[model samples]
Target: MSERVIAPKSRGFLFLDSHPTGCRRLVDEMWQAVPEPVPAGGEGPVALIIGSSAGYGLAATIAGLARVGIRGIGVCFEKAPARRTGTAGWYRTAATARLARQHGRDMVFLNGDAFSDTMKEQVAGLLAERFGGRLDFLIYSVAAPRRTDPDTGHVHASVLKPIGSPCTTKTLVFDDDGAPEVKEVTTPPAEGDDVEQTVAVMGGTDWERWITYLDDRSLLAEGFATVALSYIGSPLTAGIYRQGTIGAAKSHLEATARALDERLGKALGGRALTSVNAAAVTQSSTAIPGIARYVGLLRGVLGDAMVSPTGQLVELWDQLTGDGPLVLDEEGRIRLDTWELDPAVQDAVAERWSVATSDTVPELADLDWFGDEVRRLYGFSVPGVDYSAAVDTEVAWPTRIN
Candidate 1:
């Protein structure tokens, strides 16, 4: 491996390369932010985290390791550095595994499409052989544009559009000055099988399959728990989110959780539910049409009250493993977005949303902070990291499950 200075490359919100040093530093910070772990009885807990390379999945993995002292197996699809630098998630996972080792915890990563049957089989086998043939928790946080069905061999792609009429909303776009500008974008309605396809890719079909496969193989432990991460934004962005194609898929995901909860409860006294997490600057979130503007307002209004992905997961881990009973909404889902949806918060954001313009965006919303947050997702613009220095682009995973 050769060390080279890698500048941050981006077009709009998409990142092309990642900095290893920055990624590792960010992961290290997340690990340190987790509260000191309580002693684990016997061999401790084990978790299987799907889509564990970045975003909420990565945060959950860190909480499991640092907060709960749990050994974990993570599944993610990320590109390695070859002609260009590896994806941010690749370096993040590598860094997470390294931290797990430094703390005497076991973390195994598998790099591949988690939607496929092969990956499931591999993880199941690994659990049976190395993890005492039992899993305490399973976290589903996969975010992808398309998925190839292992059973049907059909490729389904998810679209982020409203279900009925076109949705015109105020969004944020970067201008020539490299600053966020308020813009109105109209997303057309879903046509053809767009809704079906989105549901196929983002829905609970695969989640149910994973649980069934593991249960059939006798790999689920007593009192097992599984959670699939979801998001339901405020009514302002509902047309393009909660009431959109993605929302249709998420509805299916929630329904699947209910069914799985029943099945698991009857079988092994286990539990399954959906965790509606707070909106944050994630690689997948930046692509949503109205998210940038909403998040900007959110950041400005909420300020220190808004929780980061790692912070939300840390609370979730406490709720899950603590002696206190897990809190649930009327819908039986974990509501981590309560702060974002608070009446006071929404009222404050809506007031700013109506008056937000390109000129006033900076004042009304924290566009500058939002922009930096976007860059930080790709391992750039991070504090305490010298972007000017040459660093190795290639990073290695500590233990990669074949």
Candidate 2:
């Protein structure tokens, strides 16, 4: 096998990896941090997670395995290692499987397009053969740039624009030299079928389809629970986020949760819910317009209470499988972002937002911290990892994938 060579970090170029050592170290921290397990009780041991490679999906998977010992079947779309660049998620998934095996737990991974029908069937078949055709939990956390429907073969592209009217905000961009650059961006409202396309791509249509397919095949256990991640940001971002095209998709997602809640009960004696998570820096969030500035401001104001992906999942697991009744809003969805939307927190953020500008952002927000978090996501800022060391990109991934 060929070994991967490391290149020095260059200004304006994307940093892709922090070497396998650093990647493994980060994975170890997550797994070790999982809270001590309580009795499983009525909760089933098996879970199927879509988009389980990075961000919230990876956090939930780690928590499930470490905290509750849930058997994991993860499906993600990622690039395989070659001669030059390797994906960070490939390392993360490989590490997860290795850890699970060492702990004597089952962890299966399938690397393919999550939106593909063939992928669904492949996973469903594996579940039947390995897990006896019943899954206790299913989590959908897919974030992608485009989607192609399996049945119709139609492609839908999603946009991030405000609805009803154009809106202007301060958007952050990274310069070629890896410096932060701010620009006043005015995004036009969704035109034509922009709203519909965005909804089709990011909404719950795929999630609903997955459930329908799984239930039809008797793949879900009785009392099974399904959850999809959503976000309703603070008032400052309502125009571009909550009330925008993306928000339209989220609204559809919540509606699907309601419909699935009823359908699951009738069809398989199960439940479905949408979890409103906190606004944090993720691969997806940073791509949105003006999100970096908002997150930077939020970090400065909220301090350490800004929840992490790992923390979010730990709390979510407690609610899902704990002894207490699941805390939910009147709409039957979980609100894990109680702190992000706290009245006092919002008031503070609003006050800062009113006075925020490119010139003032550095003073008012933790922009450096926000940048560090983003770099860490791409395996760039990990401690003790030598950026100048040669990386073996051809390091073997698991071959016994289900």
Candidate 3:
């Protein structure tokens, strides 16, 4: 008898994999939506955006420079080392670099950790030395689990919550029946190091490091501005984010922005701001423990209007270029996710939440479509791909990672 071996458990890594052609299609679609010529290079003024590998970081970088006529160099830390489905950042760098070259701009890729002093010094030096010590904008966004601190040699910890209430909630996963349903609360380590570690890497310290180093070297150009990314979701993710360790870190990041804004505004006649951004499922958002539930729920309500794997990217570009139709406060933090949490929407979700406990619970009205977008985000559901197409396991990347 022939033995049948089952596939290995996908673990969380499945979330990391991305389909390049789909992502490229998304990128191309976004690029086309920009009404003006995207220079593809921030040649004259210097701009820096970290965590520039995937999702918002990548989107913001592209959008900021597209119409602004500045050629920029992108630095990212990626594991898979190439422009393949395994490492989305690699694909982004590879594809973006190609566009840069074609557009008569310069794009360089530096692969490494943003937290270490070595990386910090390297980045700062690159700014000062590479482009004549001038920067017009800086974006500090680092999301990682751990980093070896170069300073006190201690791994600084990040806390995710106020030390008070511990909220818990329901989540969903496919059961043996091959159908999706709620799973009980996935309690994180009650003790709490992961949150702290995540906050340290993702929060404000690295952001500060980038700003201070660049400023000390007198690299900031006049009228320079900087922004850090943040999120405050509806109460659904309260247990996993706001009430969780990462939430604590986000709180720290928000407060730190206030602090940095004052100092940077004074010194460089520039500003350090916060963008409490829109929610879309990206690699970082998915790993936050119970986030898949929110992704599904949010998707069900808004459906395609909620998030488009490709068009939303154009939405980001529109926002960056001042052509966006959404409302924004003085801080420019557009509350895109807030509209989804209006009272009526929340009530509807609550009703669904109650039914979520049952085996026969129905799929949220727009869930399949929502899932379709999410799957497309990972390159699973794009048009024109034959599932049986042989994937080149030995595909070479545009730029090789170190």
Candidate No. with top lDDT: 1
Q: Model 1: clashing residue pairs? A: none
Off by over 4 Å in 2: 1-18, 37-44, 174-179
TM values, all candidates: 0.97, 0.93, 0.82
> Clashes in each model (backbone N, CA, C under 3 Å)?
0, 2, 11
- Candidate 2 versus truth, CA RMSD in Å, comes to 2.5
For model 1, the superposed segments whose C-alpha errors exceed 4 Å read 39-42, 400-402
Model 3 alpha-carbon drift over 4 Å, by segment? 1-9, 12-18, 33-44, 67-69, 81-86, 156-166, 175-178, 186-198, 307-336, 357-362, 393-402
Candidate 3 whole-model C-alpha lDDT, 0 to 1: 0.62
In order, the Cα lDDT scores of the candidates are 0.90, 0.82, 0.62
Comparing 2 and 3 by TM-score, which wins? 2
Candidate 2 per-residue lDDT, tens place, 1-402, comes to 555545435332246443565667678888877767534333348999898888899998888887777885899987777654557788888888888777767778899989989999998998899888889999999888789999889999999999999989887776766556678889999999999999999999999999988888988888899999889988778899989999999999999999999988987778899999998887788777788888888889988878887888888888888644689999888998999889998888778877777567778888778877777666666777887666666656666744
Candidate 1: 10-residue stretch with minimal lDDT: 35-44
